[model samples]
Target chain A: MNVFKLNSWSPYVAGGMVGILICLSVLITGKYFGASTTFVRSAGLIEKVFAPERVEKMDYFVKKKVRIDWQWMFVVGVFFGSLLSSRISGDYRKTALPPMWETRFGPNRARRWVIAFVGGIIAMFGARMAGG
Target chain B: MNLLFWGLVTGIFFGFLLQKGQVLRYDKQLGALRLSDFTIVKFMLSTVIVAMVGIYFLHDFGLVALKPKTTALGANIIGGLIFGAGWGLLGYCPATAVGALGEGRWDSLFGIIGMLFGAAIYAEVYPALKTNVLAWGNLGKITLPGVLGINHWIVIVVLIIAFCSLFYWFEKKGV
Candidate 1:
């Protein structure tokens, strides 16, 4: 079967593949299948360009160090892969906000951004504190 | 060979899997949180079980050292609460945010930017958290099997059975 042409794969098969990925991730690159660190390091990389002094001062950046490492490229690859899938399967839809969010949270784009931003902060902090 | 090539490949496959699994949908994410859909849970649980078996097997063979982080109750509890809050609010976790973007959902951009700042903020407070919240209930590096003083496979088997049962129940319930 041309998996790429299909609109979706059974969750079970996808899950199984993702599981093997966790193992392959370690075996090939000595890293686990995770995406949070890429966001963190990318933050540092962005800051380093604009405010080198601030980047140096930030303890997290000092520890994590800003570089396009394997994880970073992995995330980059994720973006392209999904883009490819959506493009192939014709499931891509551009939207500023989902209907559910608007219905539940209301229709203010600014409000949505604020909430999403706050959510990001909380999620990242939680992920870091919990270790990866 | 570039060290990143393998990671990129891994990520590409992972992305494809996530997309194919249809977990990238906002409604699916919201549904998972609302208990209206079991798709996300099954997918993630399967991955967890699979990884559990594979990682431990590889470790047993001495191919890789198992580096389990400390089981800090405080960090886990507080961090989990905070994480859930963000995830619920944004309807997109870090990985999903990227995938949503790839699927042409522009709103996930807010989450992407927000998380970047969140990381910065976490860095600023790391020192304080290290001595305080992060130190709470620090149990050292340990796993469930290790804590139980049993073979890892035993725990893995039990978890697999339990999860399979749960999946069966979900199917029965039409979830």
Candidate 2:
């Protein structure tokens, strides 16, 4: 079978791999794999650039620390890894919007941006509030 | 350096799996939210079940330590609702957003930017929110096993059964 193609794999296979990764992650780092925390941490780092004093005073920042930790690197790895996977699979494309989105939202780049941004904001807010 | 290396390695594998599983696809995510496609749901459920079983077994064998986070009821309910809403709208969670970006879906950038903004907003309001809403119903570091005083394996079994039943229904419904 060709290892490089623009097609999806079985969900069961992917999930199995993820399961192994989770177990390994815990064994290696005693933490779960999550992306929201990294985003929140990045926000803290950015806010620190503007208001170092205030950001430091914030309890969340103080507790989590606005530094590039393992999770930060993990997220970076994810981005690059995905890029690598797409390249290897020959599925890499520079599309602004996917077809599904175009059909539902009428092919407007600005609309996609707005919806994604607002949705991201809402999702992150909930994630942080819930300690996700 | 060792820890960082391990994190990167594990994350790469996880990211690969996510991309392979089609979790980064906007359609799959939106479909899962709409109850139209069960691909993402099945992937996530199976992941949870497998991880849970392996985790507790490892813990039992004294190979790993279990550090479950506190179950903050208020935070969970509020955050879950908002997260679900956002997932429906953007068809991207924090994990899938970056994965999609890596796949060269430039629209994913907006969601990432929004997530950063959202986190900043949460930080800005933390001083007030922490004392009131965020701290509500704080069930500290409680797990199902701990709460029921049962073996972790039992909880894992139950979760597997429940998830499998759901998966069967999803298959039957063809959604």
Candidate 3:
């Protein structure tokens, strides 16, 4: 095994573990796990505060929307959990581009930033079109 | 018990696993897209099986209400296709995107932002698309066994066996 490659748990083991966690989610929360909903709810809350009419009028935001309290907290937890894990595992690195990527992509921060933004838009649109 | 709390826990677990699986690496995801690796398929199948079995048993024992809604086939197919495309292009699904962020992959941050933007845009334009896109069809929460006219447990068992078989084959083929 390449210890220097990166830290990764076995896929089967990780899948089974996540599967059990999802089972717990269903049992305790009565909801299937989803990440998109949180983002939508947060956006709704933003709209609700600044542009109530728009949020209310939007078909996607009008139904089954979560309040800010729960949705934002959940997103925050994701960030924190990841940060903690990286810290403990000694795998945390702050470089924007990996070494191999730097060689291939030429360390063009501007290009990376633009790609990231456009990619975000395309991905988001695609996800929504897919019923998220 | 709240959706948010559970979502958080799920997010953490997802991130941990992604890191552990080395899936945060862009190359691994690209490999899966190229069909050279079965890691993603195996992971997804196992997840569905676990969820299906767990939900079935929970509902069966009256521990939870089985609100088995009809599966919206059109939506599912279209949604799945788009989702798969996004998975291929961005190398992260909604859940795994969060996991990627957790593992400190900067690209995942873009993916997450894109997901949020896409969702928000959908919300903004939902009214215009409601009649056509949203109401195009309705299969209504249909499950595998429900459509097949077989016992639910049998369906679950068969699916598990099939998945295991596929896993076995993949392992043997070393793909």
| Best candidate according to TM-score | 2
For candidate 3, give the lDDT.
0.67
Q: Assess the local accuracy of residue A103 in candidate 3 as a C-alpha lDDT between 0 and 100.
A: 64
lDDT of 1 by residue, A1-132 (tens): 777888888887899889998888887678876788887798888778889998888777778877888888888888888888888898887878887888877778898888878888888888887776
Task: List lDDT for all candidates, in order.
Answer: 0.85, 0.84, 0.67
> What is the per-residue lDDT of model 2 for residues B49-93, given as tens digits with 9 covering 90 to 100?
888888888998899988788887888898889888877777788
Q: Best-fitting candidate, measured by DockQ?
A: 2
Better TM-score candidate (1, 2): 2
| lDDT by residue (tens digit), candidate 1, B79-128 | 98888888888888888889889888878888889898888888878878
- Per-residue lDDT tens digits for candidate 2, residues A1-50, read 87446466778778977888899889878868877889878998888888
Docking quality of model 1: it rates as: medium
Model 1 Cα RMSD, Å?
1.7
Q: Quote each prediction's TM-score.
A: 0.94, 0.95, 0.84
Once fitted onto the true fold, the runs of candidate 2 whose alpha carbons sit more than 4 angstroms away are A3-6
Task: Flag regions of model 3 displaced more than 4 Å.
Answer: A1-6, A48-50, A69-72, A98-106, B1-7, B67-70
Predicted chain A of candidate 1: TM-score: 0.85
- Second chain only: TM-score per model? 0.94, 0.94, 0.84
Q: Mind listing the fnat for each candidate?
A: 0.76, 0.75, 0.49
Clashes of each: 1, 0, 16
